[model samples]
Target: MKEMQTFLKKYHEEMNWEISNESYEKTRASLLNNYMLLTTEVAEVAEELRKAFNFTHSHILNGMKDSEAFDLAKENAKEDLGKEFADCLAYMIKFANYFEIDLEESFYKKMDEVKNRKNRDVSLSRK
Candidate 1:
């Protein structure tokens, strides 16, 4: 992913697309779409909360209901958010391709940088 970002950055510089790199544009688009999905998730959670706490004035009860709402939120994450997540990845790859990225060379260079890095420990920590 980082390799792709780097390539996109280079492409943008070479093409002089100064507002944003292609990769960042894709990411921003993904984030915007993801935000829409998040709002829906919030709405779902709020509806669940209303159902679970329509009679509850107790703080503890409300908290538990909210927890249950979040459990439902987790389900929403797996379903709707998951779809958006996949779409984001696809868009990123498409962006890379659109910029005529040589992913193989980019990936190899990234690997080389990783291997040669002084902060080898930090690279290991990434995964």
Candidate 2:
């Protein structure tokens, strides 16, 4: 993963943006944009808060099979579970993108290929 300074330098070079002329309008616009970004991030955090421990919506959907809740919702059942996870995931993606983290590559290289391939199936283990 690239550090913030390195990523910003690369971004500036790629986009042809001059770091010298960061004027008031540019700063204001960036402030506004960052406010919007933070709002979205906070909403995602709230979603993570909702189904989290000490919350009402907990146990409404199993975390492992989250997509099934959407299927369940199609049959006149509704839970806000999907939105929560979606929002959290969206924020995570955008957070990585904002910092030019290349999270997909990082995940594959650092996590997805090692250490946790599978959880012990307790039911099968008993047999």
Candidate 3:
């Protein structure tokens, strides 16, 4: 995660896409614009899931078993889904880099905190 963040930081700099630090207003606008873009990428990820679900439904309508149909749909969607995920990660990394955040460390810390939380939600079902 650290390596990925560093690479993206360099890549953004090379592309002149780094968040602006020219002035307060410019930085705010840049951050807002990036946030909007990140949300759009998240929506695209949802679209990919929708497409996969539709494909699975279509296959089921044609008499395929639900599990088999879903497997095929998942395989078909895998590449595009991965791309969408990568897009989301890039934006997230950009923000993390801008703030000099250690994402890998933060992720582990957050997971530990969640694990030790006293008010954690109880599971309603087990698979």
Which one is best on lDDT? Answer: 3
Q: Between the candidate structures 2 and 3, which one is better when assessed by lDDT?
A: 3
- Top model number, TM-score: 3
Q: What lDDT does the true structure give each of the candidates?
A: 0.57, 0.52, 0.95
Q: Least accurate stretch of 10 residues (summed lDDT) in model 1?
A: 51-60
TM-score of 3: 0.96
Q: What is the Å distance of residue 42 in model 2 from its true position?
A: 9.0
TM-score of 1: 0.33
Residue-level lDDT of model 2, residues 1-127, one tens digit each, is 3454355456645865422337878856754655576578677656554434323223344463444544444333223546555544544554565455777578888775565557733454543
Per-residue lDDT tens digits for candidate 1, residues 1-127, read 6566675567645865423335978758755664565566556655555543543434345575666655655654455545555445544544555466666777799999989988667534545
- In model 1, which runs have C-alpha deviations exceeding 4 angstroms? 1-61, 65-69, 102-127
In Å, residue 27's CA in model 1 sits off its true spot by: 19
- Candidate 3 per-residue lDDT, tens place, 32-115, comes to 999999999999999999999999999999999999999999999999999999999999999998888999999999999999
Backbone collision count in every prediction?
Answer: 0, 0, 0
| Cα-based TM-score, every candidate | 0.33, 0.33, 0.96
Cα displacement (Å) at residue 87, model 1: 2.3
TM-score preference between candidates 1 and 3, better one: 3
Ordered list by TM-score, greatest first:
3, 2, 1
The global Cα lDDT (0 to 1) of model 3 is: 0.95
